[model samples]
Target: MPAPERIPPGRVSSVDLLAKGELTVRGRVREASNAVLYCSVSYEGEQAHCVYKPVAGERPLWDFPDGTLAQREVAAYELSEATGWGLVPPTVLRDGPYGQGMVQLWIEADPSESLLALVEDEEPGEGWKAVGFAEVGEGRTALLVHADDVRLRRLAVLDAVINNGDRKGGHLLPTADGNLYAIDHGVTFNVDDKLRTLLWGWAGEPLPADASRTLTELAATLTEGAPLATRLAELLTSAEVEALRGRVGVLLGAGVHPLPSGEWPAIPWPPV
Candidate 1:
């Protein structure tokens, strides 16, 4: 088998890292049922601890094709880089453990922060935006949460841009560096109106100026024959890519955050 791909440790595009690197499987991530492994990669005297998800181990989904989730994860990283938000840690796809899989730099997060509790605050605290409330059975206190942190706000916009179908709370991690990383994007970029997420806190609100600019840039990147378009062509279906572009245009035109269309459930189950 061709050796695993690797890249410079800290400062390269996901494309660069994924395109080059020698991968070595270190161990398995026992917490997951679908095989996830810990890996180490190195190239050019640079090394990184990474997570690798081999295509051979992915569980089949009725709604999504088999062996394609790894590619979607890479696509999400690519989109994150295109937006210049640095919200997704560098990710790439290459040969690994069992076969070709998605590989990404492992971000260690602060143990101090609990995004769930932060959002569950009853009051709309500073730096937070409350979405709504849910009842717990009959007499139990209703559950409430507000998506807090400007980083989450950015992710909300990105989720919309990708037509992300799963943005569960556990997918978010607050790094020790104080930066937030959004992970587990294997189910994103569907060619449908499926932006279910836990980030509806800013629903219908105006987009942040910078977020709008990023969307505009992304639209340009999706134009025919653009670099991003070319890369995406390798991973996503043509229809899905077109849908991504259309969604960007829609967001730009609306100039505000989107509200649930009610065509599907707006949130994922077991939110955190």
Candidate 2:
């Protein structure tokens, strides 16, 4: 498949506008386990309403260290930017209403369209595939689906490179303009193999040429003496960064989509 067209970055300066922006809490998103609040962030006469997750409000997890998820979110954005895929929303770590944490641009999605419903449709839409089935009640069922869009396929490759451990269906947001913004990347960049996603639709398929080239470039940038690696060091441990570099090498060697290891889950719980 041809490479997804690379969207040129705007004439605007490359600034962490949201991070430096004045943030005010509009309301809390009760659905999140941690304190994720919706807020209006204003900076340099520009204003945007976005999600804010304060480090002080973070709920501890045994698998991940405390006060680090916020940093991991930023790290995810950094990796996304380096990939030039524009798959993740603009995110940064900054001091917010409560304390220091993550702030991300809010994606405006078509609420009328639901991924769950589309996946469970008796006849699935074009460019989409059913990965597995979900048991509802006796004899009742639902299907888990993922898009075949090149951007999404690239994102699946990106998830593997970052060791993303939790990629739930609800984390995908399709904007009104057909852009897909992936969010909630707090559990990422582990030194171990923790990839858990719902994007195995193309498993075992050869990695597209464009995807392979991009991964190759990313692998180069992640090596010692590279600027991207320097930036990653500030967000992740040395070991974790090395692990990321290792995954890049592994992906380059495999040259094909990965299948479930069966040692760990291939999908997230509460998939949607």
* Lowest lDDT 10-residue stretch of candidate 2: 1-10
Please provide, for model 1 over 55-111, each residue's C-alpha lDDT reduced to its tens digit, 9 standing for 90 to 100: 998999877878899899889988998988888978888887588898888777667
> Model 1: number of clashes?
7
Candidate 1, RMSD to the unseen true structure: 4.0
lDDT digits (tens) for residues 3-48 of candidate 2: 1122225432323557677888888788898999888776666666
TM-score for each predicted model, relative to the true structure: 0.88, 0.90
- List ranges where model 1 is wrong by over 4 Å: 1-19, 118-122, 134-139
Query: Clashing pairs in model 1?
Result: 4-22, 4-23, 5-21, 5-22, 6-20, 6-21, 6-22
